[model samples]
Target: MSEFAIHSILLGSAFSTAFFGLFAVLNAVGQIIQRVMLLRTPTWKRVYQKKQLDTRPKDAVDQLPWETWRLVAGVIGVIALLFVLWGTDYVYGSIFGLGAAYVPSFVRRQMKDNARWRLRLEVRDFVAELRLALALNVTVSQALEHIADRSGQVTTSFIERVRYHVERTLRMESPEKMLEALAEDFQSEDLRKLLVLVRAALRGGMSLAEALAQSADSISQNIVASAELSIEEMPTKLILPMLFALFPTIMLLALIPAVSMLITSLSGVPGQP
Candidate 1:
């Protein structure tokens, strides 16, 4: 009888300790996610310098979606972790499994996002290059080739790809048509709108340099407005989890000793004293 009671106590203690540790770790992870979700991630440049990176300009123009990948990886990770912890004390194996599945997709998403941001920054520069070449009596095709040679950074991008395609496919296509084709390959709405205005300038025989400057100024204003909106909302986002978790945690910490004493007293007077 005594042996049975001791074994039962041991089992209970082991499970309690395991559950307590798991809940604490999981809660910490939740807090991290909540905090990160609130961040604006000003740019994706930092996410670009990791593994599975293919910096091909063609690939940059068309990025793969990662939300579905997240769902698949999460399911697989949970299954794998459940298998590992079935009869083992290694409950933390779940953390390793989830991270293994998540990190690659996260890295890829960041790279694509960063690439989009760079595209935004370089839009004005691209227009300036085109306008300058036109001012110097260069043909549209010649200007594209020159931009490709001069402006490429760590990765060749939609700009370079469009330049190469125009040189090969349609030697007679206008500069506006080339930009429109480039916009088709890319998913940027701003670029598409700019391409339309550029095409209109060409059709109406307007000054190309003036049109480019106008479009560039419009994009700059949009970027500033977006930044201001993000800043205004940051305080409320930052407070949400703290109010929900940290405040309660502080109260629990303050009340813990009294709660413990009440529980002890309620256990029938501590051996009849």
Candidate 2:
């Protein structure tokens, strides 16, 4: 019945109310997102199913759409922000929370970029191998089967998908149509060029081996040129990181001792506490 006890009870009640209110808001947002996802689920499923018929083992949790994961990340970020707000300055908490919210998306973007780079390298290898296979006078389908048997990790699934479609529609569709469709799906210029040459060969406009050899050489040269250019630009690319991250860190470290000494000196001055 004392003032301190009454203040504690009121504070506890406020904290509980705030926590529950935040939880309710987050729950409502999640439900809305879930409903939106559910409404779009059928379309997504249909598109994926139509594009890819092969069954691949995937974790149930991994199957959740990126939007759902982003939402979860955002909710976690908001909760973390609340904790930060309670424990630190509002400005720092806001900055930390905003950065945390975008972390998932940024990581996802980097992953996708890395995957694309790997796929580009894999496609170059695939083209070289296909060219070699063609030089042996094997049919395009046979060459694909040979490549699929030895494809790298990045392209194994993609090659298998292509092979599946090729075999499934062998009688009803030309390889050109299948390749064009795949090129559209992947949106790779290098792959599209290779497919275009292959299609030309399939249509009897050029010799298959000659066409593949040319495509392979062009792709190899491009890859080499890209590698050399990247090497040449490496130092330039590193300059920004040094300026933004390394320089500031070095400056901070160098200034810390000087700042501390100045502060100590000022504190030691007569009449200064």
Candidate 3:
């Protein structure tokens, strides 16, 4: 209705058109750069992540060396956006780009947690199988060969590698060394410690049953402690946003009108003064 309101609407419309125009140019430039990279054979292959001749998921997308290229392209996009708009607009673009970049990392973190849990469940059965082999007076190599034969069992590959490597150690006359190598290859803290214990037991002629039992117990306790610690710390870590951000905004929403009324009442009480 007023001149001020009319001018404000016009300014808003101008800003919207300018923003959309910049976005259109940015989108076109991004597509052009992508196509240019796709022209060269190596560059095209890097962006697309084509698999090798051997087995693996065709769409796994393991294009590693292209990471540098992606980073460069991202930097270029942000710089272009900032120049086209302003420094303030760069913040918006950065926040959006960062979220897109970290989507894969966040998904991988969750997947790793699930993978660890699956591995732990399988390890429980594995420990039981190993104990049974020990009870039957079967050598470690014999037990592992039996484990490797269990088709569709995910742990079979690891067991087969260890069994094959250990068998080679038997010919070389260094079983302890073989155990050490197994620990390194497996990349497992529990397995590495267990191997160290195995070496010590072999050297000192300690009871094998006692060593295996202790290792299993130790691993289970560590898992329990880890779970407990995570649970306890979660509330403390979670309070921050609620305390600093959400709580204040909510409180202001509830109190702002009442506070304004109180201020008006106090200001209007001037006749008594």
Candidate 4:
């Protein structure tokens, strides 16, 4: 083939491949957008917003500066790989750079998970403390303040937020309103349920101490049950990784000699040689 024709054919193939890849990426992104939009009901949106709040780190001072730096680093890395190293190196570098931008988000997600589990545990402790405080004849407001002081970081932050609203708008008749608001803010089913029962019992003139004590016991039981369930499932979770890693290695070791002998026999054939 002529040099011009060969170059033209290569260019056409490259353009076609690039175009198809771009189209696929766009199609995948569109599908994700559609799926997200489909679930954009008011209730789902509220739940999503609560999740966002829970996942966001309270200590985050500023994201803009770090995000800008990441953007610049990605651009520089892509340019260096594409211009200096060329070819597949550019593809790999671009992927790595793009993926690196999402590392912070992945880290945040893991942190959020850790924080959530810790919060659940801490909340159990808070409930226990509140139960004790109520038994000691402390008021609901006083119990909250005491727990805010005594609880771990995760639960303390949550209580402090509630304390802010409570202290700001102290009402003698309906102290449970502050707790109800706290439950709404927390978006935690356990916390919400406990608060709702407390509100109902207190409103009905039931013994606050006994109600709180019951709530504490139930929350403690739930926490223990959840932990036991996780322990039970641990072995099942390990099964897949053991199959993927160990099974392949064992099979490869068993087959290597047989495969090698077959290759040797084939190579020794006159036609094969």
Q: By TM-score, how accurate is candidate 3?
A: 0.51
**Model 1 regions lying over 4 Å from their true place:** 1-57, 60-80, 83-88, 137-139, 152-155, 170-172, 229-273
- Candidate 2 has its poorest 10 consecutive residues by lDDT at 1-10
Listed per model in order, the count of residue pairs whose N, CA or C atoms clash below 3 Å is: 0, 0, 0, 0
Which residue pairs clash in candidate 2? none
Give the Å shift of residue 66 in candidate 1: 8.4
Summarize candidate 4's per-residue lDDT along 1-273 as a digit string, tens digits. Answer: 223332332343344335444555676699899778757757877788778676433523233344454444445444533432343213323433433433444556556666667767766777777777877787887877676556435534565665565555444435577666656666677788787678768788567776777777787788789889878998997795566446434544554554455556768953333
lDDT of each: 0.59, 0.61, 0.53, 0.58
Task: Indicate the residue-level lDDT of 83 in model 3.
Answer: 34
Which scores better on TM-score, 1 or 2? 2
Structural similarity to truth (TM-score) of each candidate? 0.54, 0.59, 0.51, 0.52
Q: Which candidate is the best by lDDT?
A: 2
- Candidate 3 displacement at residue 133 in angstroms: 0.9
Best by TM-score: 2
Clashing pairs in 3: none
Q: TM-score-based ranking, best first?
A: 2, 1, 4, 3
Q: lDDT per residue, candidate 2, 38-139, as tens digits?
A: 677898786787556434422233344766656665565556545543532232333334444555566676566666666678677777787788788887
Q: Which should have the higher TM-score, number 1 or number 3?
A: 1
Clashing pairs in 1: none
* Model 1 lDDT, full chain set: 0.59
